[model samples]
Target: MMPRLDSNTDPFRRPNTNHINSIYKQNLSKFQNFSEELTKRYDELTPTKKILVWILAVFNVIAVVLILIFHSYIIKSLVKLSDKWADLKFGHLLLFTLVFMVGFPPLLGFSPLSLLCGMVYGFPYGWPLLASAMFTGSFASFLVFRYLLHKQAVRLIQANEKFRAFSDILKEDQSLLILILIRLCPLPYSLSNGALAAIPELSAWTYALASLITSPKLLIHVYVGWKLKSLGDETKTFATKVVDFVSILITGAASALTTWLIYSRMQRKLEIYHSSRQQTNGDYDAMIFGNFDDNDLSSNNNVELDSNDFDADNFVIGDEDDDEEEVELDEVRAETDQADVTKSTSPTNSP
Candidate 1:
C-alpha cells in the first residue's frame, strides 16, 4: 500500500519555496539592470577618450613643426658659443668633456669633439688634458647617474630580457670584471657606464676599480688625437678617418669576444651553483628521512656504566623472589594477550 503523508509528521518541508524563487528573480533583474548601466557608462566614455586622443595627436604634430623651425637657429647659436669658448683652451676641453658625458649615449658619437680638443691643446698638452677631462667628466657622470638617473637606467635595462638576465648573472659574483670588460671593450661607453651604475651589485669601489682599469682606452684615444694634430691637413683627415674606422672595428670585435667569454663563464658558474644547490637539497632530504647511514645510534648504548652512582650489588635481587615476580608478571601478560586475541577472533552479534 502507498504510504499516506502528513505535513506535521514529515521532516522534509517546502514552505517559502515560492518566496525564494521570487527573491532570486528579483536579484537577477537587479544584476541585469546594473550591468546595463555599466555598459551605458562605458559607451559614454568612448567618444570622450577618442576626442582626447585626437587632441594629443594634434599637439604632438605642432610641437614637432616648431622644433624643426628652430633647429637651424639653435645650431647657429651653438656654433657661435663654441667659437667664443674656443679661446679658453682648457675650458673648451672641459666643455667637450661635459658634452660627451651628457650627450654621448643619446647622440652615439663623441670622437670628433675629442679630436677638436686635441687640435686646440696640441700634442703633449692635449693628450694629458683630454685624458684628465674625460676621466673627470666620466667619474662625475657616473656618480650623478648612480644617484639620480639610476631608476630610469634600470627601467631601460629591464625593457630588454637579455639585459635583465645579464643583471641577474651580475648579482651572483658582483665582481668588477664585467664592468671593466664593458668599459675596455667598445660597448657604447656612456650607455655601459649608466647601466652599470644602475646595478646594485656593482659597489662604488668596484666601479672605481673598473674605471681605473679601463682608463687606458681613453688615454689611447687621446694619444691618437694628439698624434693626428701633428700631421698635414690632408694626412690628418685621412688619419682621422682611418683611426675612427679601425677603432670602431677593433672595439666591435673585442666587445663581441668579451661578451661571448662573459656569457660562457656565467653559464659555467651557474651550472656549478645549481649542482651544489641540488647536492645540498639531497643531503637535507636524506637527513629529514632518517637515511643518513653514517649515524650510529647503537654505538651510544655502549656508554660506560657509572660505578660511583650505581652499584650492581645494591640493585641485585635474590633468585627466589625474582623468579616468583617473573612468573606472576608473565601470567598477567598471558591473560591480557588471550583477551585481545579472543576479541579479534570473535564474530559480531547484533544487539
Candidate 2:
C-alpha cells in the first residue's frame, strides 16, 4: 500500500505553471535551433567529402563488428592456419611485408597485418616483426613516390587545405617532430605514407626516425591478438579469463585514447597554422597593394582623395545616408562645373 501525502506536508509539490511553461518553450526552441543547424551542416558537405565520410563510418562499423562478434572464430581460424603452415610462416610474413611496402591501395590498413603477426608469433616477436615491416614499407613507399609520382601526389595534396597546411609545417625544418606526430595520428599507415611522400623537403632519415618513434603503438594491437589466442582455452580458470578480458579492454582503450590525443594535437596545430596565415594575409593595406607596384601606379592617371571626402556618416555601408551622400557629391560637382563654365564665358573687365 502506498502512503498518502498530507495536504500541508506534501512531498510531491506541483510545479509553478509559469515556470513550467517557460521551461517547455525554452527546450522546444533549443531543439528546433539544433535541428536546423545539423541540417545546414549536412547540406554543406561536398559530394566527395560525403562519400569519404560514409566510407570511414562503414569501416569503423565493420571494425567494431569484427572485434565484438567474430573475434573468437577469426582468431581460431588464423591460429589453426598458422600452426598448419608453421614452416612457411616466416616466408609468408616476408611476402606480406613486401606487399605492404608497395602500398598499392593506400586505404588498406596495417593493423590487421600487425595482429596476424602477433597471432603467429608472440608479442615480443610480433612487435619487432611489425615494426620492421612498417619501417621498410614506409621507406619503400617514400622512395617510390618520391621518384615516380612526386608531381601528381603534390598536386593532389595541395588541393586539400588541411594537407597543404600540414605540408607547410613540414617545410619548416621541424619535419622530424611533425612526422612523428603525424605517425602517432589515428590515420591508416598507407594513408600516412602517401601524405609523407608528398612532402618534398622531408628527409629519409627523419621519416625512418618518425616511424621508429611510433612503432610502439603496434604493441597494443599485437597484445590484443596474443590475448585472443588464449581466449579459446577450455581449461582456463575463471579468474584467468576475467583478467585476460580486462587486459584486452584496458589495452584497447589506452591505445584509442592515446591515438585520439595525438590526432587532436595535430588538428589543433593545423588550426593554429591556418589562423596565423589568415591574420598575416588579411591586412587591408597589404591586400590592396600586393598586386600593384608604386611604379605602375605612378605610370597611370592618379586621382587624389581628400580626407574631408571620406566622412564617417557617408561611409556607413548599406545605410540610407550612403545613397544620400552619393547624390550630394554629384550635385556639388555639377555646381562647381557650372561656375567654372560661367566664369570662362564672361568677358574680362580688364580687356
Candidate 3:
C-alpha cells in the first residue's frame, strides 16, 4: 500500500462539536491553508505579472486608506457622481451588466463588484440592474454550447457515463426545481452556465428563467451595500444613524437565517432528487452522483470528465457514411479528457 500523506489529509476528520471556539479554529485553519495555496500559485506567475500584482496590491492599500480618511468627502463625490449618471443611467448600468457575463474578473470578483453597485445605486436598483444581465449572460452561454460549439460541448458530455447520468435526471418530474436549485446554489457562474447549456434535455428559455431564483442573493448583498453607502452620509442625525444601525443588525440577522434555511432546504431536495435519479437510472450509472455531498456545492470547484469512462451506452458513434464525424468526435473527447486529466491529477494523485 502507498504511504498516506499528511498534505492529502482532511481537516474535517474530527467529530462534530458545535462550540464557537471550535468553529473559529476550524475556519482559521481553512483560511491559513487557502492563503498558502494562493501564495504558491502567485509564485508561479511570470515576472511581469508579479510586478503588476504588487502594484495593484499597493494601490488597493492606498485606496482603502484614502477612503477611510476621506469617507465624508468620498460620499459627497459619489452622490454628485450619481446625479451625473442619471442622464446616461442605462449606459452605465448596461456596462456593469456585462460584468457577471465576463466571469472571474482579473482583479475584482463578483462580490465586490455587486457591492459596489449596491453602494452606488442602492437596493431597489439591485435586481433591475442584474436580472437581465444574469439571464442574458446565461442564455448566451447556452446558445454557444447548443449552437455555436454544439459539437465540442456534446462530445465532452457524451464522453463519460457520469456526465450522461448527471444529465439524465431531467427525466424526473420537478426537474425544473432541480435546475432552479442549481442556479440558486453559489457554484462558479460561467461553468454552471456551460454545464447546463450542454445538456440537450434542458431548453434555452427554461434554463434562463431558472436563474431568476438567485436574484434574492443579489438583493441581500446589494441591500448590505446600500446600508454601507448610507453610513457615509454626513447629513443623518444621531437618531437616524441609530435607526440605520438597528436596521443593519436586523438585515444581517435575517439574511443569515434565511440563507441557512434555504441551504438546508436545497440539500434535502437534492438528496431526494438524487434518490429518485438513482432509482430511475441503473444502480451502476446512478451511483456516480450518489457520493457527491451537497455541502461541497458551496465550493467553487468543478469536476472534469475523463473520456476513458466513455462507452457505447452513453454515446452514439456516427455511421459509415459519417466516418469522418465519428473519428473527429472520438478525437475531440480524447483530447479534451487528456487536458482535463493532466490539470486535475498530478504525481500525488497516484495511489
**Each prediction's TM-score against the native?**
0.42, 0.62, 0.49
lDDT (10s digit) by residue, model 1, range 234-318? 3346667566557656755765686667655655665676687689899888754535334455555543334454455556334
Relative to the true structure, how large is the alpha-carbon lDDT of every model?
A: 0.62, 0.73, 0.67
lDDT of 3 by residue, 1-351 (tens): 998879537776775467778878966986898799889979999999999999999999999999889977876776555445545748555546655555421223566556556766778686567555656666777788787777666665565443454465554543667677656654556655655557767888777667766666677767776776676677888788678768888987987777556655665665677887668686665455434557656677874555556655676433585898888999999999999999878666456
Of the two candidates 2 and 3, the one with more favorable lDDT, higher being better, is 2
Regions more than 4 Å wrong, model 3:
1-29, 87-126, 149-206, 232-234, 245-351
How many clashes would you count in candidate 3? Answer: 0
Error of 2 at 82 (Å): 3.1
For residues 35-105, write the lDDT of model 2, one tens digit per residue: 99877877899999888988999999999988789877866787786555445846566636653664533
Q: Provide the lDDT at 78 for model 2.
A: 76
In model 1, pairs of residues that clash are none
Score candidate 3 by TM-score against the native.
Answer: 0.49
